[model samples]
Target: MPNDKGRRRRFGSVRKLPSGRFQARYRGPDGLMRTADNTFATQTDADRWLVKQEAKILDGDWTNPDVKIAFGDFAEDWFKDRDYAATTRERNAVVLNRFILPTFSDLPLREITTPQVRRWRTDLIEAGVGAASVAKAYQVLRAILHTAVDDGLIERNPCRIKGAGSVTHTERPFLSVPEVYRLADAVPPHCRALILLAAFCALRFGELAALQRHDIDLEAHTVSVRRAYAETRAEGLIVKAPKSAAGVRTVAFPASLAEELAHHLAEYADAGRTGLVFVGARGGVMRRNNFRRIWLRALAATGLGDVHFHDLRHTGNTLAATGGASTRELMHRMGHSSVRAALIYQHLVNGRDHVIADYVDGQIRKVKRPPHGPSGT
Candidate 1:
């Protein structure tokens, strides 16, 4: 029998098989023994393969052959490990099943290439997937691959399509103060306070929907955002804590609406402190699907049909910005966890260009003219 330990290479060991083929094996980064996919025809071929693997290891790009996990298998584990909100989890699952799996389901995590990622993205756009959808799906895939890299399942993430993960959103419509009240009036009597609170308090629809009678303190002129509602197939109308730590804040409403709020509490609000602040016609939890009917009717009646209900929050944030709210203040008031969203809303402050121009003119005038005595000096 040939000395089965045929040769000792610099990086790993090569052994001659019973069938006269040479096999290469090495210890991987994960401290596990790994073997090449196929036996080499000769000892030189096995040594050459080991040399290449050693070079890759030195360059920090070697992947363990034992990590033959398929993309679908890794993705299943990835999804299970995610601790995102219910709605976010649902959205990710939908995107994975719809867009990602069809392209890379059976492919090994290590076999995914950057060129393949680029082509997949191109194919998605050509197949008429919306730009936003493509961006979202690309983000999901990139995130999964990044985790795979961190987990040492792959040498590197192959998601290198530049700007493929960004989506440009169209400018959203914002309502004027009068337009907010007009829409509020157009909605049903019970829903008027809901609309006004959404606009003035700068509250998200879920936050408003999750409100309870005790969360509002008319005397304090503040509303406490302790929780939010999310719609999910797994759990209908799941009530959960705020989206972020900053989301759990007490926001004040102007005292101008105190009367409206008190009246709403006495008339429309349910009896208990924990009772729903806003509810359906039958005094049940408010759902967007059911509320869309009322919302569409109010839109038609207000002649502001094109406006999205979420735009009310935009209008509120814009008003706050124009009122000279700082970046930090905007983040707090908007319950934003990042400065990005706060800055986006802050840019909507009208007349800022004129304000800047006037400021520059004032500086020039101050330099040109100095205060003088009555002698006109």
Candidate 2:
């Protein structure tokens, strides 16, 4: 038997198992026993593993469980522990089941090497998975491994290996001004005001869909972004608070726009505080798919080839940028988490720098430059 010090150490020792396979055993932070096998073909391999295990013991990082558990199993445990939204949880579970689990399910959590992760990432890219989706999957794996590390299941998170973040994707798409007007003309008259408010006020689709009669103040010309609609795999449609605390804000509307919304509320809204501002003809929450069909019909009528309804929010940002709104102002209006998002909208506006140049030119022209002194002089 090893000395008492070695036995008491968190990462205990390398010893031969009954089947003659050398193994390293340790006690994890969770107070559970764990073991890692040294399936070396040669004594050199066994020696190397012994050295590593001793070093890990000194560094206080070793915690390899003895029983071989699949990466998929560990990932599931990690997922269950997270306090994610119902919809988010379901979506993450689906992605894991569909994309991640099948590939690494049988592999031991501790045995998953950086090369394997890299190869998996490469395979995902080759299989036409978008970089964003792959990145999200990577995040999920990283999070799982991080929890494992915290639980003392492993010395470190293998998912945090270098070169695990090289994925890239195109930016989110938005719409143009004319496209916005065309989209407005496409939606039904009852929904037109809501659509305009969405595009012009930069309200998210969920926020617009969940808007109640009391949330808007026509006299004050403001709309409060208090709640949003969300759909979960388990619970279906549900109303929830804004995505972030900062998302709860009161947005000032233009006078004309306020009047338009006021007129809409009086004519279409039901006689109750909880009445939805924009609902289906039968007076229920607006379904994205159903609204999408109506939106497509409207786009066709306006002769626009193809555009997403979400693009209208981009149109709102573009319109704000064109109207000389500063990035900070735009961010506030759009409820963006970062100014970088607001900058994308700035690029869509025409004559942006030209307008500044024109202003500079007017100022420079005011100071006639001494009639351009004679060339000889």
- Per-residue CA lDDT of model 1 for 297-355, tens digit only, reads 99888789588888988977776676666666667667887644444334435534224
Q: Estimate each model's TM-score.
A: 0.77, 0.72
Q: Candidate 2 — which residues are off by over 4 angstroms?
A: 1-60, 160-167, 171-173, 176-178, 324-328, 337-377
Which digits, one per residue and each the tens of the lDDT, describe model 2 over residues 238-357?
998876655676666654455567667877776689888888878888878678778778877887665677767776676667667667666666776554443533532443333432
What is the model-wide C-alpha lDDT for candidate 1? 0.80
Native-referenced Cα lDDT, model 2: 0.68
TM-score of model 1 vs. true structure: 0.77
Clashes of each: 0, 5
Report the error of model 2 at residue 286, Å: 1.0
Model 1 residue runs over 4 Å out of place are 1-62, 339-377
